[model samples]
Target: MRPGLFASPRPDNLGLHDGLLAPAPSTPNGVSSQATDSKHFVAPLPMPTDCCVSAMEKLHGIIESLGHAEIISADDGYLHAEFHTPLLGFVDDVEIVCNEQEGVCHVRSVSRMGHSDLGKNRQRVEDIRKRLEGWGYCC
Candidate 1:
């Protein structure tokens, strides 16, 4: 349970549907079974997973040319990058998602500074992706 939202993690005996609330079943132990449907509460979100070191190198150069540093963060199934660009003497953060196997990446600006600058930087991003493809990294 999130802080300041509930007294405890106990399931609420009320079910919500179409904005209407209804009572939920109580378990044999007197615990509310509302948590039984908690599994449905978390819906999977779309994620990009196609990325490769070659593509990462391509993106690194693109951001580097913009006076930024590319930081790669990877796990077993995900490869994410955070681009730290110097803006107004401070670092601006940008996020990148990629599928390591497909060598494809979806880049986005997660910070305000990067978002505002994205419109004018589209060509640069495209250039990097194209370069990566020319080198045989493809999705």
Candidate 2:
């Protein structure tokens, strides 16, 4: 079978919209730091300093070290990555946007398929938050 064969269609709202990473899908398979609802809201990672560029670079390294993450695109303030599950080969798209003035990294993570992810999306964000915090960044 092809990779992501069971994956849902690429979301219309996938990338940054109006200078913000797209909101999490209404389904429980997604979560976003910028979301307004408790179900979709995850806290943005707080930067250790005023340098968002350097912070993003650090985040890049962290994601790479997480194993299944493949960074599809990245710039000083924005990044996109794909994370694959080990057994079933599910794919999740993760995006991060750095706000320099606010010194935070806004993030969104969504499964490409499924209405429920068994809390995987939320766990991943929490994991990322913990890892970033260990690096002296806050979330």
How many clashes in each structure? 7, 0
- Could you tell me which 10 consecutive residues in candidate 1 have the lowest summed lDDT? 24-33
Q: What is the Cα-based lDDT of residue 17 in candidate 1?
A: 40
- RMSD to the true structure for each prediction, in A, is 16.2, 2.6
Model 2, residue 74: displacement in angstroms? Answer: 1.1
Tens-place lDDT per residue, model 1, 4-80, is 22122222322234422222122111111112454211111122354455455555555556544444444333233
Q: Best-fitting candidate, measured by TM-score?
A: 2
lDDT minimum window of 10 residues, candidate 2: 1-10
Off by over 4 Å in 1: 1-67, 77-87, 100-103
Q: How well is each residue in 2-43 modelled by candidate 2, as lDDT tens digits?
A: 365464545677677898888778899999999999999989
The clash number for model 1 is 7
lDDT for residue 28 in candidate 2, whole number 0-100: 93
Residue 138's lDDT in candidate 1: 39
The Cα local distance difference test for each model comes to 0.36, 0.82
